[model samples]
Target: MTTGSVNPRRADTRRNHERILIAAAESLAGSGEVSFNAIAKHAGVGVGTVYRHFPTPEALILAVYRREVRHLVEVVPALLAEHPPEQAFRVWTTDHLAHYMMTKRGLATALRSASATGGDLPANAYEAMVGAVATLLKANVEAGTVRAELEPETVLRGLGGLLYLDSADEWRKQAAALADLLWRGMCTHRD
Candidate 1:
């Protein structure tokens, strides 16, 4: 009875944590704000639960940021497994990285508003993104889809234009165009 009870509690806690993060992410993405009351209401949990999960707005924002970065890196393998390397790169750029850049702008603003008292975000974001890019590039190179000597950093830089995407406009189409251009630049033989 004790074991079963503890399991349910833990599962509930995990669900609550995810819900809180999702609500917080939506708030940050929309208004660049973090109000515990609003997040709790949006998450359908008590305000105390929001505080229990993240004691401060900074903690919540940082958690959202980390989650975004982790997803950007973690999705690479599944993408490669599901599609050819070239298609995987396009899907990641247009789907994952582009979305991250949009949310990143909001997150950046929220972080700045939170100020130094929140401390700085970890410095591993760029390195982790670069590693993800490198993995994609390696797969493409092995398949002879991309030039062998191309640098992942270079490819990432080319994709950096995604940071300024106009969310209100046709951003998906724009992202696809940008990815197409980058694809042309990286390809050994154009399709």
Candidate 2:
């Protein structure tokens, strides 16, 4: 298949792949380990179809993680377009926290298991996150809302630390407070 060419069969395959990923993520987020049959059923596809796309559960898990990470990173531009730079940063940080929390423990364990088996998650996960932060920080700096000397990696590392907190209801509240604190430190004119 050539670049930019539209093949109906390939499009259909991509749709199925996306559906399976979404279903699997939802399953992993809501509860414990989900079987391939359950994922297939949730996706409205047969078991064979799921297997054809992802030969192993590890592959499926990793794919979902990568896709979600990409989505989070890609949303920075849109967020900035809709809100002020400081507001955009806060919104993105909150959204990022929510996404991480939604992925839940089961998906996390699968990622760790896959990494242990040398099917490691992509390093670009961190890079993508830092890049998004950098993009938002740059705009904020230009707008004079954030300090010019701030480092995107510093903010990213701090927020990354929050992702390790216990996944309890109180932790969610704390995470939001921590994000707000981080925003306060980053900004020049605090509200």
Candidate 3:
């Protein structure tokens, strides 16, 4: 019974919210216009539970986008810690490309809805993404593994075309090849 202690019920509620977001993301990945009932069923929760967590589809979409962005931003440091700068950057970028491919459909729809409202959606998603990659790039530059002049935003912008690829199965293969190309272009020396 300490002040500022976590409440079990509140923790459970937060867990449920995250579960709902994950389910919604999965549902939206295939078709951007998935029904709330489908998302609720996917999450193994009642429709009322979903509504309690997200009052509107826009709210759910916004939350999903924010969560996805947060995951990308948060994983960078851990990736760098576990791998060489170049390897970490490649792995992170590859993961990002895959994530974009998986979520592109729903994310596009969500972004349009959120933007139409001019709501609390974080508009700095690119900035956050580039910043994370920049950290890895900086480390590689310092290590002489990558070019010192490479700009994180420029690299990200260059990879933007991958998002428009027509096939999901091909996305993974093409993304890997693109990552290899990027790695070669950025490296100080060819192995």
User: Which lDDT values do the candidates have, in the order given?
Assistant: 0.89, 0.81, 0.80
**Each prediction's number of clashing residue pairs:** 0, 0, 0
Per-residue alpha-carbon lDDT of model 3 for 1-191, expressed as tens digits? 67997899999888889889888888777677657899888888899999999898888888888888888889989998999887887787777655655686667867787779865778798899888878888989988998889989888876676676545466667777878887888889987
Per-residue lDDT of 146-180 in model 2, one digit per residue for the tens? 89998888988777756555544666667678788
Model 1, range 1-63, lDDT digits (tens) per residue? 365455778999999999998888878776778899999999999999999999988888888
Please give the lDDT score for candidate 2: 0.81
Model 3 misplaced stretches (Cα beyond 4 Å)? 3-5, 165-167
| TM-score for each candidate, following the candidate numbering | 0.91, 0.84, 0.90
Arranged by lDDT with the best first, the candidates are 1, 2, 3
Instruction: List ranges where model 1 is wrong by over 4 Å.
Output: 1-6
Q: Model 3 — TM-score against the truth?
A: 0.90
116 Cα displacement, candidate 2 (Å): 2.2
Candidate 2 global TM-score: 0.84
Q: Name model 2 segments beyond 4 Å from true.
A: 1-5, 161-176
Candidate with top TM-score is: 1
RMSD in angstroms, all models?
2.1, 3.1, 2.0
Model 1's alpha-carbon lDDT is: 0.89
**Which one wins by TM-score: 1 or 3?**
1
Candidate 3 clash pair list: none
